[model samples]
Target: MSFIESLTLMLALMYIASLSYWSGKKWGAVVTLLLSIGAVAISLYWPLALALLIALPLCLIANKFAPEEFKTEIKINTLREGCQQLLALSLFLVAIQYCINAIQLKQGSTPWLMRPDVVDAFLPIAGGIELKAIVTLNLWDQTHPAAALMLAAVLLTGLLCKRAFCGWACPLGLAGEYLYALRKRFIKAELAPPAWLDWPLRMLKYLLLLALFYIVIGMPSESIPYYLQGNYHKIADLKMALFFVTPGLITLACFALILALAAWRRQGFCRYLCPYGAILGLLSFASPLKIRRNTQHCLIEAKGMKCDKCTRACPANIIVHTKTTVRSDECQACMRCVAACPKSAALGLSLKSGHRVSHKGLLVLLLLALFALPLTAYLAGFWHSQTPDNIRMELIQVIDRVGH
Candidate 1:
């Protein structure tokens, strides 16, 4: 394994170990510690090996000194946020690695750094087209197969676990969390729109989803192969990076608008603008797992008490108390409702068959669904790009002149 890969793995293991220690799970800590040791042993790099040795004891010391309340509350939110941060950091590192390779390729030199295949996740439009080609022509994407595979992985996550990907793994969702936090701090309110306007705004993403599909699905199957092999599609990731790197006035305006909206109303961009989230939301309807209300255990139903903690805690504003099963498309399966319920058994994520999934179980399932396809593809030698470096070098030279 490369140094970056080994370092990322070591850091991820150590992060899990620290979280487990802080969350008071002895077994988790021990197992992760062993894994961290394995990572260090295989790393072979002295600096990382030394850092791991130091980090483990420091984590132990930090855990020992943490307050009792701190330990208790570091359960659900901590696990979810930890996963988000880890995934986001991984993407950021992959972006950096990608930039290094792109820069080298542009300079007419073979890339010294390994180009990360996962960066293809940025090319969802291409993925969508490639997926269509796969379905229609049985042709796998040779150019950026990882893109289609990653899209499939995400769809599987949505199909199996609702919008758990959005809640537990999305980097944008993490950013949205911070934006909403800022809103709470500065604006002192959610500033939610009235239902009359909110309902239509919520439909925006679905409309965007429709528009995206209209383009992808309408393409002639014969055209897909040509399009996928085209110069524009080949270097789509570079173009994507450039958009962010050299944002025009309209791009900046759109970003500012999205940020402002996210701050004004929780997950504003996700709730209304993210076509990916919209697709997931629709696919999530098929998921057997959902946040279900237990009437027998609910305080309002069982004890004649007024309680709406679950509803209030929900970021998506689903009326958790009223629904026997939260069937709203907006529900992200975030478990904030479950976490906030005063009655321990009042609200829980359960299958239609009444089997409950523990928080940890959900996390595991989400991770599996999110990575299984890409991992399988990687193992099968289909994850790496088949495009030649010579071709890539030529494309990067005239990337500014190439367009769809």
Candidate 2:
């Protein structure tokens, strides 16, 4: 985007943030503010950065002086949706920038636009390998350090916030949501697999995760440097982009299956295929935050009613009402159940001590934990790729021929 366009987006975000704060959706305001800051910082527009820095203090002041009514709790579902939309847009822009850089390199010219290093977030396999290298050999990946940083950030998020990343930030999850909505339009009832089938299907992701770990962990430590510095690894992101852009018949068929399964069951891809999500789901077991049920406040226990709204509202098909504490890996921490409950106190995301973490506070912590890596990495001069532009230009030309 041009300077004028970026400035307009920043100002628009700030305006929406102000409106969100005034309307008592404080998390929405905070998201917009953070997005604006990220936009300026990534683009390295110091003037706009100064503007955001100034506006941030003012926003904090406004929030502090706001009336009690304006501090009302944000609906977690709404906050998740807003976050999904913003992140979708951000990723879209990154894709555009990445393609533009590739095009520039293909034309044998230096890219005028700075490459968006965040694109490395897609290279989880590379990141995993690099992480092993870091642990075993004290070697940092020069080609895609951002990948490792992103991996750390996501792992930290999983450790602290469950699978909120999948619920709120993953683009694939956002796409699956629309597919789910479309499914609901045609099928009035939920279509879930029986336990016999569901259990095996869910194991697919874990098995895939194990296969990935086997390859990464089983590699001789000596070969780590060779793999990281290989030409194929240097253009792995471009190779990934091409996989979607120029998918073969098998790739298309796999996509068809994914869409059909997602329509048939909620979060089917995350549940059955995403190795990254499998890692997060496992780590989330150690997270202090979980959805806790209060029998004293619940309609099922307190009023002897046959209410199962929380269970019905769950996209993950978790029986939220049956469990005093939701410990299932399938739980995305989306808080759909909490929002669906008739009694406000019946369901909540709480620590072990029963101290409820407010939705706003959760958003703040999740975002901070997730972004902390990129911010710190950037400050430490480790976020961007160290690959020279001339080498990248040459590599893009033979990207098709380069292979593992």
Assess each prediction's global lDDT (C-alpha) against the native. 0.81, 0.81
Per-model TM-score, in order, reads 0.85, 0.86
Among these predictions, the greatest TM-score belongs to 2
Q: Assess the local accuracy of residue 83 in candidate 2 as a C-alpha lDDT between 0 and 100.
A: 75
> Tens-digit lDDT track for model 2 on 119-202?
888988899899999999999998999899889899998999899888877989998888988999988797888999999999
Q: Residue 359: error of model 2 in Å?
A: 1.4
lDDT of 1 by residue, 88-146 (tens): 98888887888899899989999988678778887888899999998899988888888
Angstrom error at residue 386, model 2: 0.9
In the predicted model 1, the residue pairs found to clash are none
Worst 10 residues of 1 by lDDT: 1-10
